[model samples]
Target: MGNFAKGYSMKDRQFWVIVMSLGGASVFVFAAMYSVQPLLPFFTEQFQISVSYASLSMSMTTLSIIIGLMVLGFLSDRYGRLPFVRFSILLTIIPFLLMPLTDSFAVIIFLRFIQGFAIAGVPAAALAYISEEIHPQSMGLATALYISCNALGGTIGRLMMGYLTENKSWEIAFLCLAFFGSIIFILVWLTLPKSRNFTIHRRFIREDLYGFWLHLKNPYLLLLFGFGIILQLSFTGMWSFIPYYLVEPPFLLSLKMISFIFLAYGLGIIGSPIANALANKVGIAKIRTIGVLLLVGGILCTVSTSLALIVVGLCIACLGFFTTHSLTSATVSRTASHQKGLASSLYLVSYYIGVAAGSTLLSPIWLHFKWHGIVIITVLLPIIYLFFLNYTLHKKMP
Candidate 1:
């Protein structure tokens, strides 16, 4: 285990190793989760399914994550953090490695479910671990860095999958993912220090159960959880249809060009900490409101025919999503200090529930009304969510 001396916490060798390893793990986890998104159009053509059915590939994974987060979140609170997190990373690798061997879409979707279940260990445990281990003064920055890594991972994974699948095959994309994923897996397994702050406890005890109950009852946390769900639903629903939108009609963009569009996710890396800093001055409620407005504005811009305006809109939407996500995620822990792991799990439960629903539901709308219908669905949620957030903050703060 790494030393916990003052020198070690203050940007020493061990601290950097821990941060870098966690960041690498963040990249791998999201990459594995979202890499399939860019392949949705190909899935439709190959499987002879509608856009709605093709979306099942991504939806199934997120739905599975909901189950995993629920189970692992509570279990991690009882068991130590390191074991669950390590096991999660290791187990997630199996599905990706196996992806190349499958031709059946059903089998592939099933594997994605298993992969989501495995990766649940990361988010369910990582935030709790960071809060437990990182020094209080640097915790915000550490968490922001992790969020940045997530954004980068997502961007890289989508671009890599889209490009490789365009040039070679989807199987080739999965193989490349397996290769890089394994290396990052080993780095995290070797470098992430064992938990310095966790106290192992018996599972399902009365006190622990009561702690979870209290978190569920807290009005502030419930509001934040609602906000998370709405944000993810809007964000994921919009993205789930992008490849389909660009591949047809007026755009006719290749998979490579569509992949390049996801590079907009890079804005999240800048948005995460900037939102966090602004939250300190303007407060979480106002910042969240602003984020919702930006997101709505971006969605409106996508209705334009111009490619340049669409890309600009995508960047704005990504920033808004990350800004809201970073603040809300941090607040989950703060709202339930005694049940941080459980609270984190619940927040993710809400987030993924939104994702699964949005991906599946919005696609059918796309099938009917096309992009205009999608824009209608995407733009409405954040406006309503922003108003709700304002009311909640007023009630709680007053």
Candidate 2:
């Protein structure tokens, strides 16, 4: 009984530590994604560029992150998780601090790309680490906690960036992010338990590569991959443009007011873990369908300029996104048994592809359609997503 109590206590402590570490690392991702969002106006004004060029601050970071996810994901298979996670995040520190000093817009973008690349190191490995280390029965809740941290960090990063952007220079914002990243990295190294289940990465010749093809061959894998992309596109499209929509006519909401919408995302941290518990209780697939409906409904709210309605919609949307993301990520991990690391990389790759496509493609929608036009296009996305998800579900059924 004493041994049992000790084991339970140790597990509980490790659980909380991993949770804090994942959440801490996630701030780096949120900082990478949203650090530039509030600074859009500032970048355009300082660099003498258009909204399109200024938005690339977000785009370049995401684009690099995709590369990072793929490359690092692959590397984690050949090497252990910690080295890459540490190397990638620690490397980002220089570029982030440099961001404040660079005079050339081009150089700033290059630095941001490096920052994006560095941020990519954490995700796949973090998930895999938890999956391997945590008890199988606890995997769903553990993964959900990791993802919730991701959402919460992102929510806080964007909100804080916006608040700072209201009063300070864009350069200061990047520097501030560097400070946060460094502090978090330190905390993570100190707190996270050393991997007990992790083995030394064996050299991969050609046979090591087959695991990739093997996972992709599964039809369900293909469907889940596609779903990740569309989900990211929908979420990124909404977030990348929200500042524009809320700050526009009839509303003229300030950057600070727009930042407050991210407060809704705090609710996402709560929703994801809750949703995961519920999904496991009922069924992930069944619970996920409801999540899809939430995504559609939330996007619709942004269509109206009504402040209260949009706010409510954003909260709901945040909840939906976390639910879907947590479920899909867990699905990919469980489904791909042979090379979970590579499988994770692909899921992340698809996810970032959606982000890149959304951030790059939707700028034109904003330019031409304004908010309603953008909403119309985004709304079509979820409608199509529902059809495909349903089609895929039915195929599974019979």
Candidate 3:
């Protein structure tokens, strides 16, 4: 824990401002990142690309964020969090503004690449800021509140874009989102509190690299990190392609109707908190297993051709995704003896790598095998995940 001066309370004006500003920043980060999700179909048609090729629009961003996180994670440590937070929001604005101007698929992907690197600053700083500056008692609630904003942002971005694309051009949809993001960027700049707990340090890259290697060497942390990958792999893979599956074949839904289906992500906001509560009634280990089972079960449900069942399956899968993610994130934070920030960064890197892998690599499976192939591969991941998680429990954390 970083220095938290006495008399600093969650009830204070600064505390609420900090929380709200961070939440607003979260809305920008996730909203910008996920805005393209609903537009993938439109991109495919306009660019005349295959489903697997169209996925580059999303995958490239995620991969760039992985690169950004590695670099920015260290830079934030040296420069403090506030500057990075502000700088990131500002940099992300460029991509949003320029995205609609170009009709070229390559141009859009390039912009998303910039957006990914710019947006990485938010997550890189948010957690460390909250944990260091806020009251220890309030940290959990504050973190949960920020994540809720993330979930809501993702849902709103997809819904708004999906709905707008139904009536207006995709360009109009992106331009409007850019405008909204600019407003949030202003709010964060004006209101976000200056960092009080972080001390800037100019550490060598070799030292940071060694720290990363040491964290990876921890058996338990390594297990949790891998768990992060598996969770995102399954979740992102499903969401990315589900739009394709729905728009075509047996259950043909309009963009507006499919946007409503993404409302299922709202279930994710509740899932983590509910799972946290139930962890008291049921043990954490058992709860984690249940979350994985829910993921597998959700996938199995979607294997059906029934439209109603597919929607239900998506909702169930999202619940599992959020719950398991919350638990594993908490576990990683608790298990680390020091340098929790570095460990968390690595865990997130693993998570996004999963996303990048799932959306890109798994699309080929869909091309070759369709829905059955996607389900079959996703369902198997959770079982392998179970083995790693169980072995981690027995292995013990240092």
| TM-score of candidate 3 on Cα atoms, chains taken together | 0.95
In order of lDDT, best first, we have 3, 1, 2
Q: Against the correct fold, how does model 1 do in TM-score?
A: 0.95
TM-score for all models, in order of appearance:
0.95, 0.92, 0.95
lDDT of 1 at 230: 88
Q: For candidate 2, lDDT tens digit of each residue in 33-54?
A: 6667655665677789877887
Candidate 3 residue-wise lDDT at 172: 82
- The count of residue-pair clashes in candidate 3 stands at 0
Worst 10 residues of 2 by lDDT: 1-10
In model 2, the runs with Cα more than 4 Å from the true position are 1-10, 203-205
49-94: candidate 1 lDDT, tens digit per residue: 7777778888999988899887787788788677777778788788
Please state every model's RMSD to the true fold in angstroms: 2.0, 2.6, 2.2
Error of 2 at 348 (Å): 1.0
For model 3, the stretches where C-alpha displacement exceeds 4 angstroms are 1-8, 395-398
Candidate 2: lDDT of 293? 77
